[model samples]
Target: MPSLSPSSGQSGLSGRTPPSPSEALTVYVVDDEELIRTSLQGLLRSMQLDVRTFGSAEEFLAAPKVAGPACLVLDVRLRGESGLAFQQSLAHRGLAHLPVIIMTGHGDVAMTVQAMKAGARDFLEKPFRQQEMIDAVIGALEADTRRLAAERSLDELRSCWADLTPREREVLGHVAAGRMNKQIAGDMGIAEITAKIHRGQGMRKMRSRSVADLVLKMQALDVIRRAA
Candidate 1:
């Protein structure tokens, strides 16, 4: 896996600010057993990982969070909530993008299936090798980073779309739907030349380099709904 640390000299060369410690990847552990929590926390800290441990699902949920790439190392059984069920609850509350790795002492095939179906990124039985946990945690964090980046891109696409003029927006929709300039002008009750101008302006404002690119950006904004 790639290192989470910012590359050396990147900030110097690009004049961008370096990432702070709070932006480093974190591993959040939630297990009811005090010994287990401390032991795992010690292990992760030894690896230079930022680790936070909670005694229960409710406690973990209530804790203030850091904004960065992170994953939950969750044990299956808790004081008041089962990990699998809590996974479902996370999805219900729109926090499902948070990755979870389930660990348990009494896991079975059915439980494994349920956890996976409920959105667990990985599972490990108690007493597993340390390397296994480390690898799973790294993979889970990467998955979450990708999800967050996608959402950020979608938000930016929506913002750019919001800046289009009404006529430019209409021409964009037509072009995205594969309408020719002449056909778009006929349908929109404008001359072909005027339609061409609006189409060029829309493409520039949308920052799209091709019809395919424009289509994808607009799709991210659900512009098809407005076009329909």
Candidate 2:
């Protein structure tokens, strides 16, 4: 069966606009069948997604890396090394973050469950509906986009935290924990005014406008645990 067989009624990837260059999404298709790879590539490209096709898992791993949000569309049965095994090995290959959508002509409940458990975002049977494939690709891309964004935010937060003085960090933590300036000062054996200075400095460095904002940022950075 063809990897992507557009049903007669389906028009095209409707109502979907390509993301901005800065937020471009990519999809890598791995199917041993040249026809399947070509078909899937054409369909995904119509949506303006960056599509790459590989004949085998090794070829995919050896390909020059494209940095940014992307997902893989893998067939369960490949020429060598089954897709499920490849999915399980992704973490070791530095692709743990890559989302995968598994498709196969010889699928079963057991296969679907195995794929899902291995972190496949979606499972499709061969000759799948074009719209179904489109939806799965879109969903995978969106998930990867969110993951990249969250990682970026976390990195920025860590950089900001790294810039704070040790004293400032201590005062900020206490402040985020709802400690008053005097209490923080007493705990640190410093003057209340000194504690206030450190708190203000830390808040500015963290770009937090208030105690609540500081608390939220700290919680996101895991500098302070969330309240039970």
Q: Which candidate achieves the best TM-score against the true structure?
A: 2
Whole-model lDDT per candidate: 0.80, 0.88
Across 1-228, the per-residue lDDT of candidate 2 in tens digits comes to 565666675665774554454866899999899999988998889888999999999999999867788999998898779999999999898899999999999999999999999899999997788888988888888888888888998899999999999999999889988899999999999999999999888989999898888888888988888999
Per-model TM values vs. the true structure: 0.82, 0.94
Which candidate has the top score in lDDT?
Answer: 2
Clashing pairs in 2: none
Off-target runs (Cα >4 Å) in candidate 2 are: 15-21
lDDT of 1: 0.80
Candidate 2: RMSD to truth: 1.5
TM-score of 2: 0.94
Model 1: worst 10 consecutive residues (lDDT sum):
12-21
**Collision count for each candidate, in order:** 0, 0
